[model samples]
Target chain A: MLAIETKQLSKSFWKNKVVDNIDLQVEKGEILGFLGRNGAGKSTFINMLTGIIQPSSGSYALLGVQGPNDSIKKKIGVMPDYSSLYGSMTAINHLHYLADVSGKPVSRQHCMEVLKLVGLEEHANKKAGKFSFGMKKKLAIAQAIIHDPQLIFLDEPTSGLDAESVIHIHLLIQQLHQQGKTIFMTSHNLDEVEKICSRIAIMKDGRIKKSGTMDELRAYYQSTITVTIKHSPIRPADLSTMQQWLEQAGTQLDIKENHFTIQVESEQKIAEIIRALGTYKIDIYRVDVEEPSLEEIFLEE
Target chain B: MLAICKREFIQSFKGIKSIIIIAIFLLTAYYSADFSDLLLSLSDDFTSEEKQIIHTVGISFLIMFLGMLFVMGLSHDIVNREMHERTIRFLVTRTSRTSIIVGKFLGIALFWFVCLLTSFVIISIFVHRFDLITLFQSASLAIYYSAFTVLLSVLIPKPSITMFLSIVIGIAFPILNGWVSLTSNVWVSWLKYLFPFYYVEEQNYSFLVVLLLAGVMVGIALLVFRRREC
Candidate 1:
């Protein structure tokens, strides 16, 4: 079953459409990465879905409940792009307060578990205002899932974290997904999204340009292998010889700075190029082949 | 609702804004020796009639200041803090908007009630030496004024504006009642019944009637606030 579904959801601020008509869906137990640049309406779309801001038009449902429904609110969790916490309360107090307000029977044990999950057990007694930016972000996440919500909306969860913290958060998200939680998150870090998300939706200007499973998206935008070869004492004749070899093998080649980057349509041609270069006794210092990354696909679009 | 209320109560004290207001109130009330002495001297010169007027005016001013502070605190607590901290989105998942509005109103009301009660106890100790009847009258008036002020806090979006309007209404209504009594104007006499301050003059009405009136104002405030966006 679909955990979340939106049909032509749109939102406007002062008559300027921030989120245009956009249809989106996430299957149960799926980690869907919403990729977009800054000011690309990624946060706006998440806000609309969570009912922080009502949509201008269209409809959406969470865990089978419709929009503006109080019951549905209980089934979801949201970590906003910015920190929203009571500064005077300690980190543990903040989580407990949210857990209580969530109308669930929460205990000291539960609060401890959540703090541990966020790696904030030591800082739990400290006031939230004294926490660093990264710690505050973690506290926000801890509050979001304190109710054990079935569905979660996380907006740029790893934007400002150090590398170690980023990895820790990613692992926590993975653990949640393993426990059958449905997550919908947005991020500009394509590497992180590509590493963890089962499906991705690329958005631009309040519209989704493409969306599908990673494999499906990769298949849609065919992967090209760029083979960079480093050679010494290269001359114009050597470049001509490389071009002829590439042309014969039906590959496209570009050369600059005594190096040739050959674009191979398929991986099968990679072996053919190696064999041809071996026959010519050309001094091949190194050969590097790179597949098309999500960054490359986004940039190409 | 209880859970939401508890959260609000605990979170309220954590805010620096609330602490500053309480600090100001305590400093002004405890250190203003001249004002306290003036109140004592005025009570001595005045007969029961003038004492009643002075007590009403004094308690009304105190309640108005408390009311304004409470209203501003609650408004900033409910609207400004959420937006400034960017926590509204996280809160939406745990509770409905109605719950938030109602919980915040009640939480702030409870806070004001405690503050007013403490002030009333202090004032009572001072006035008890003057006349036992005047002390009772002052306590009763404080209770009534606090209730009205809390109602205004819930209804108004801005604390300062609500404080101003509530003070004007509280003072003007009683003066208007005195004017109508002297002029013998039929229209004015009939309209005086509409003001709550008029009811405070004689204190002859049944306790049930006062309670009923307070309930009605609070109910109206809740109805209007529950429907408000954000």
Candidate 2:
């Protein structure tokens, strides 16, 4: 079954539409990265799916159940970006309370184990209010997965963390991913998303502007293939012949000394250009193909 | 639901506000019994039933004033606190929003019940004999006041503002109710229903009034809260 499915889901505040006609589906066991700029309705969409806010229009299904089913809620976990922990409660106390409410009660020992998983074992007795921002964030993550949910929604799971904490959270996310848990995460950190997410959906103006795998997005947003070529000492005659051959093939070429940078039409053109250069007796040393990064694709109009 | 109740119940005792309120309640019970004893010692013709009624009224007065304040303090932030802290997201994702409201109301009601029982223990120390109906009234009154406070907490975003408004309406409305009696207009007398004092004074019908009021407050709160966005 699909982990999450939404049909033209939308949310509005007065006349302002925050989530507009977003149809999204997340398959089981895949990390689906949700990316959007500020005010792009990323949180609103998560809120609707998690039952925190009702959609003004459209409907959604979670784990095959329709519309915020209690049975489905028990199967899903959420790490909200803006959620705060109880100040006076210890980490274990917070976990126990959340676990019980989620219908998955745990002992203090179990709570400690979960805290330890989040690197909060030593601070188990400290009140949440006294915890540092990064520590509280870790606790929020621990609470989200306390129930061992089938599908987990993590909103900026590693946001506002030190490098070590980020690495720890990344490892935890990888561990969860390896355990066959489907994760839907939203983050502004493009590099992290590129590393952890299997596929991504980019939202703009309350609509999904693009959604695909890394290769698909890169290809969709980019058309030219940039090939940098290094050749052995080429005489001026050979250089002129290579330039003429590249121009005839309709490739954009730049030459400086023995280095030739060619922007070709497609992947097929790279092989064609290399063969043409070889035919010209231009000895080739090395070749490199440059593909666009996810960030560049995301920032494209 | 029980889990939410248990956490809130424990948290109530962890703070000094709850302890201070309960201590003052015990003191009020003591004073009520003492005043009743002084009046009874001076009067010779008063029957046991009449004496019981006098003690009930005196204690009810203390509860009507101070008990409402305690209820206000106990429940004024139940819903808004979660919203303000942005912690409602965690609970709402795991449980139904209706469960959240119901669980919190139950938790606050339980806390108020404990306070009432403690008050009964204190009242028994001096009066030796207390009215069972009065005990029931106090419990119902506690529930009634808590329901309104819960409703106000859901309607208002700010806990401090909710408490301020609750105190004004809870304390001032009754005082204004006295002025309403000077005019014999039917509508003016109808305003007495707005205050808990009217129902607290009812000897035979207070039980029904308190329950019905609690039902209305909770029903409205649930409806409004269910429609509210996180």
DockQ of each: 0.42, 0.85
The lDDT values for all models are 0.70, 0.83
Q: Candidate 2 chain A, which ten residues in sequence have the lowest lDDT sum?
A: A242-251
Q: Give one digit per residue, the lDDT tens place, for model 1 in B128-156.
A: 42333433443444444444554565555
Clashing pairs in 1: none
Top candidate when judged by TM-score against the true structure: 2
- Give the docking tier of candidate 2: high
lDDT of 1 by residue, A1-301 (tens): 8999899999888888889999988899999999988888999898788777788899998887778687877778889887757777898888888877778767878898999998899998999989899998899889889889999989989888999889999999999999999999999999999999999999989999999987777667754667887766455566677677787665566767756777776667878887776666667788897778899877876
lDDT of 2 at B175: 65
Best by lDDT: 2
Candidate 2: stretches off by over 4 Å = A222-224, A238-241, A244-252, B43-48, B56-58, B177-183
